[model samples]
Target chain A: MDLTFAPEEEAFRAECRAWLEANVPRGLPSGDTRDGFGVHLEWERALYGARYAVVSWPEEYGGRGASAMEWLIFEEEYYRVGGPQRVTQNGIFLLAPTVFEFGTQEQKDRILPRMAAAEDLWCQGWSEPNAGSDLAGIQSKAVRDDAGGGWRLSGQKTWTTRGAFCTHLFGLFRSDPEAERHRGLTYFLVPLDAPGMTVRGFGRLDGDEGFAEVFLDDVFVPDTDVLGEVHQGWGVAMATTSSERGLTLRSPGRFTATAARLIELRRERADPHDTRLRDAVIRAWTDAEAYRWQTFLTVTRMSAGEQLGAESSMTKVFWSDLDVRMHELALELLGADAEHDDSGWMKGYQFALSGPIYAGTNEIQRNVIAERVLGLPRK
Target chain B: MQFAFTDDQLAFRDAVRDLLARECPPSVVRDAWTNKHGRTDTLWTRLGEMGVLGAALELTDLDLVLVFEESGYFAVPEPIVEHVAVAVPLLPEPTRAATGAITAVTSLEGQGAVAYGNSADVVVAGSDAGVELLEAFEVTTLPNSVDGSRRLGQVSSSGTGSGVQIGDRDVFRRAFDRGALGTAAQLIGLTRRMLDMTVAYVSDRNQFGVPVGSFQAVKHHLADARIALEFARPLVYRAAWSMSEEDPDASVHVSMAKAAAGDAANLTAAKALQCHGAIGYSYEYDLHLFMKRAWALAAAWGDASWHRSRVGRAIL
Candidate 1:
């Protein structure tokens, strides 16, 4: 029930704030969720080197192992500094945990350290052009070699995050056409430079080429490269995908930053005629704070080791959609000023518009809440 | 950090829920907007007696829980939050411990009868003036293109009512936050109910090919409604939770909760009505009953923009 940070945490917060004030970049992210790829990658390395990244991980793994609340303080300051998101998000957020869970001792030794240091750039190869939300629908097939050891893979996985630049790809490939939805898949770790695999780039709404259409053509993979049991790939991928409690890339406070930025954008143009716009700005203000508290509630649930359920789906869905609200208000507030992309606002607006389509579509999250969280039958 | 309500709050919530089902049923709400009198002396007296106006004020933990649940299930026809936020602080220890209103908010425009215009016994809303308790009468309805839940009406108040006027502006606005957070909680309930009602009705109702809900439009819209409700519910609770934490950043949560819940309730209520279609607009249908309450609460205390600005300033 207490909101104030303990004196120690507050002091730690001040220390971090002081550090950021000294070392962090001067300008903010221009409200564009997308950052320049080259700059973002370099920033990721610098952050990891400084140990300011991965606030929740064990210090041995290049993080501060901070308490959940302290981690939030870290994010609040990070956003205040307006630093770029960790460029190797797939490596840090998704794969590192998966490796820790299923990886062999050597695998952990080889990957975890690199992952912690951002030396391992990972791309997700789960979804295909046809498989959209249904991971089981992936037709990208992998077949066993004659020696019955390594496998040869051939298929197309699109919307592969950072596939163009990432060095490794962790993916779900159909190993047996006969196996049912949850049974026949295999999770594999394939180096991007492996023969037959090609990377093709695509543009995001942020105008960055972080996403790519990865074509897997007869790529070789040793048996040890498989993430989990054969024909049990779905289980591994599902566990990884559903690992909601681990790292929260979208901290609750991010909503606050987004809201605040909208207000700043409006304050520069503050005029009496802008009452409606001002009102929208106020709404964004409340929304950001409300959800952060809501997030605070969720964080406590997680800290108490509560199982991940439908309730947390609310945050992902709300934050993304509310983010759109802030932008829509921004667009409305800016009106004619909206077209002035030279100042980076229009780009920000477009980025917001694209948010719902990212992560999981808002529709998918609702289905999860309705069917699983609310215990309602699926339509 | 705990989600569990205190033992007293549990008992109080159960009682409030029980009382609401019997007293201000959706049917009554439906009736009032149509031909029936929305508020009666007895109804008002019962609410006062039940501690509806003062649940958060002076009641025990049990009383707070009761209002939380009440705020969820039944839509309050009056400014119960205003009563709780303004009156609870000023009530006698017995009443305050019981957690009911201690003092009333006074508004210059007075209680308009249509919830916001003159909904408070002591209007605690707005800056410049403090909680303005005025000589008030029952609400008289006016037709409008706006909300169905909030019947717009005009009222004149006697300025002689017992209440204090505020000299400082910040104090006036802070009073509104407590009420705003309370209403946002209610909006969560309303959105959930609307989603439930729409889901139940559509799942059964037949259409061109199959059950109308089987169609993608119905499913997606309901799903979207579900998403809105889910997203809003947490934010609403977050604000409430923050209030308990008494964090200065609570304003962050209050504004966020109000903004998110207001938007979600409006979206969900609209979709719920759309799903019910012809029946939704009819007087006999209960769909509009929820809609009206949602419409009224969405704009209460402050609208989306007001909340957004508070959040914006905090982070920026």
Candidate 2:
């Protein structure tokens, strides 16, 4: 198998490298401060302006319509140049894919471009306080209006990432009260600014308002806002969660960049006799390289039109575990200063802790692997 | 970038798999454990005739990788990995039959052990003057390996005129790296087989009036094994790719692959054995055959700790 990219792909990489080098912001603000979030939004706008925001999307969706290989190269270059994390990830990665897959042409024409441009930041509304791992257990409800014009939603969605500043929320709501779990649910696109809707910001473990509690009280949603077929939200939601846990949420390039940083940090250490730390550093790098190659294989399959099945759960379990381990090793290598929250390693370690819990727990992913991939009998 | 084998490579692998299925099945593996010299000469000759022995020199990198992986999957008693991946690349033309070498100085010293020291016509041994090929007939053999089918033992040249020097320091180092890569690929293949066997046994074997595979405990073990192999498989190929291209960081990638694959294979073996209950530990069963082979190969070229330190040295 050939590892090197074709000449045209190489040229695409060069183009990405040049654009990222010229346009990437310097000394970008970090954390959940208003100013920092605003700067990230502006950066997303700048990316959209250059058509580098969603390189793998269709041209009509305000993307370059690049190949999977080009997208991988873009991701590699984006991380290599220390590109900022996408503030619009929920919209651009999770909901946008679902919209493209399940939304009507009218929805696509109206929604994707705005989402791509970051004009309407989106937050997920999947997990409620009681429905963390068992997402189908969510109690959120939406009822059709008596006049048959719209639906009124009433629910509280916790762990809503970027809910504090996001303009919209996409979620699964119970449309039929009599129907059982995962059967009567309907996916909806709701405006956070709708009447009776409120977002209560809360501090994460790292003292950032990256996630919040979104409360919807009799919020009216038009019929046109329904994402997919009525009572088919479970299937639509799977598409979103799969994309969240799969390639888009944790790309190999991100881990590669982090592993490179860890290596740099290790090299900066004066003492080289710490074999424990040394081995950990190498393990981090090895796992990252493995993930990169594995993603290349997955990309090859995708290019050949092969759908990723339970393998996405395996990827989620692997990358999330690796992320936690890598960050833990980084903190250990940072010595006593690792205790400080201001240190980037400590912050990273805090964030990595949430990876396995979100999207889906590793325990659930393992169950998925056991049942679907290995053909094990379900309990 | 493509990460899959070409059509020719797949066909070659299928051929190897078919041949191994017929000639090197579980019964043959079990027989070799009890058989004298533990050498399957007929199978080795057939492989040689198929050009599997000279594949490293004759085939592309991907083809050789596929062959090595298949050899590991079948746990072929012959030293095809040693002959093709390590010894063949460095030796001159007109290579003798079924070369088995020990470039690791530890395996050579103290007891002066070398794998297949008896069956190999020419045994390459590492010494202070680099690597040299010694005529097996001239050296005395002391048999007994932990893996019964391996036929490993100590070999003493005894002033057989210091043997014939075939490669120097750099060549020896590259040989060791290739050895590690081959071992890594074998570990991956063996581990994959272990995983499949465990899945089949668990699905069919019942306990407490239900199939044990239905239990979350059993499923989790297999799931972890699958995940480990999935991640490690790519590293093996990447390392092989690096070595084939003679990349500057080839050594580092080789160390990473070996370390990752060794750890993955060892873990898979443990879980597979645990899942198989007491039957897995029996000699009559085929499970122990792979277990022994994995144990032998895990520490063959370089163990996990050794490779980890090498990678650490490069990166840190």
Candidate 3:
């Protein structure tokens, strides 16, 4: 087992660190807000210009076609220099992989470059009022409009992160009403400005307009917008969810950076006598290190042609739980000052709360692990 | 970075696993509890014949860790960690070739008891001064351990002509790290065994006319255990890699692995016992064999808290 990066990988890391150190904007607001979203879009454009936006994607698709190990190194370097969260993640990390895997030449040509450049911001339109955990219970309908050579979408999608700002959405709709849960659904890429569609921004727990409820009333999406086979959206969507829950969405770099920052905070504010809090900080740091190594193992397996299936569920449970615990420890270190502090720990804690709930809840992921990974009987 | 074992390493692991499965079953482990000296001579010789005892002489820490993990999987009642990981590597070339002679090592200062002390033909002790190979030692057997096969005892130099000075302080320090890394690998194996046993029990055992595994609570419990072990395993492997490479941060990495594996094993033991209900609590059940081994190992080299504190000093 070789844990040390090769000279080329280290060189790539050095380049990424230098670029991110110089280019990352100072004092940018949270990307969830309107002002912050615009600034974040500018950063994404800069990243794309440097060919660092989608390092793992093919070169033709505005990426360097970097290896998975290189991509992880890029992430580590990016976060080490305090790079902001990628506001374009829904399109770049989640939907882009699916599109590359299943999208036609036309879709790939029209979608990827713009998504990488943040010219066409996208949001996930999966969870609805009744379909948060049971994603297959989507009530959205896509009726064939033969005359218009398109589909007429009618549905309401809630908890659409940054939907108010995104120009388009990638979601699921029932194309075959007769087919029950998990079947009949077709993946659709709908423009937010499509006729009869409205996005209503709402306050999340953090009191930011980070979420929206998209109401679709007879919105027309042409056949070209369909992703994957019309009725096999479940399989396509699973691929995307796996990306969301696994490597791409949350890199170990993010947690390890947060862990480093937490250590700094402890050094600055922690009570020396509070051994419990000290221990908590240590556990948080080690957990981050553990996650970093785990990701390396996973990337190694993936590079060796192994497919990651239900095991991704274990990844989700671990990092999400670690994220929450790390933030909690940070806040405890801050003590009473945490309540009104603008140090981002409070905001990060609020965001971490959504990790376990989103990307399919931890409970659902555990069921997947037990039944699929462990071969436990499901009654 | 290739963070996986090579094909040769995996082959070695599988070979050891097969050997342990056949030679070191639960009955063999049970026998260690009542057997004189708590030693399985036949299994030891077989392992020696397999070149497992001479592993440190020919293999990297990365390769030897895989063997230690398999030994823990079978709950092999031997001083494999002490002999293979610590004592064997530090022993003189002549002494290292004597694979039949069982060796055990202990820290001279804080260690209260040495595992397999009675069975060991050579006892090595490490301290700030250096490492010493005791010529004649007296073993005072301690009380029966939670893991009956462990066989702990106090070792004192009997024919004290100040035992042979073998290695210096740096050698002892590195040996401690190797011992911890080996134990960490063992803990990961023990954790997997417990989780696997619990998953099987819950899948077959029923409650309210349905398999208890179907209950979300039971599924979540086992799932959490699996998650802990799954994540901790990479740390152990990476620690082995670091030690093999003689990385400057090897001690910190070893501490991380031991801390994580210790926590994962202890947590899995508790969840496995709870999920198995009354049957898991009984001594006759096979689950305790692994559960108790996990408990004893978790506290052996350094408990989770101690290792974490060590890690805390390094990072914080």
In angstroms, the error of model 3 at A79 is: 1.3
State the weakest 10-residue window (summed lDDT) of model 2 chain A. A26-35
lDDT tens digits, residue span B215-245, model 2: 9888889899999998999888988888888
Using lDDT as the measure, the top candidate is: 3
Clashing pairs in 2: B108-B112
User: Among these predicted structures, which one has the highest TM-score?
Assistant: 3
**How accurately is candidate 2 docked according to DockQ?**
0.72
lDDT of model 3, residue B124: 82
Q: After TM-score superposition, what is the CA distance of residue B254 in candidate 2 from its true location, in Å?
A: 2.0
Minimum summed lDDT over a 10-residue window in model 1 chain A is located at: A26-35
Candidates in order have lDDT scores of 0.67, 0.83, 0.89
lDDT minimum window of 10 residues, candidate 2 chain B: B103-112
Q: Write the per-residue lDDT of candidate 3 for residues A167-200, one digit (tens) a residue.
A: 9999999999999999999999999999999999
Superposed on all Cα atoms, the candidates' RMSDs to the truth, in angstroms, are 5.0, 3.0, 1.3
User: Which has the greatest DockQ?
Assistant: 3
Candidate 1 residue lDDT tens string, A1-379: 4444688788879988987778776544421123555566666777778787676777877888888788888888877766555667777777776777787877877777787776777888887898886767889988999695889999999888778877899999889988867678899999999999899987776666757999988999998888878888877776566543222646766668777777787777667456666666666665566566666666667777986665555566767778778777777767786777455457666766756665667677666655565444454
lDDT of 2 by residue, A1-379 (tens): 7888999999998999999999999767763655689989889999999999999999998998898778888998999888888888889889998998999999999999999989988989999988888888979999899686889999899988878989999999999899888899999999999998999988888778888899999999999999999889999999887888888878998999999988888887526887788888888888988889999998898888898778999899999999999998887777787887364778778889988888989898888898899998885
Candidate 3 segments exceeding 4 Å error = B93-98, B101-112
Please give the DockQ score of every candidate, comma-separated: 0.30, 0.72, 0.87
lDDT of 3 by residue, B1-316 (tens): 8888889999999999999989888988888888887868598788888888888887899988888888888888888888888887777653543465555556444333688887777788887789988858888888878998888888878875667888888888887888888888999889888888888899899889999999999999999999999889999999998899999999999999999999999999999999999999998888898988898989888888888888888888
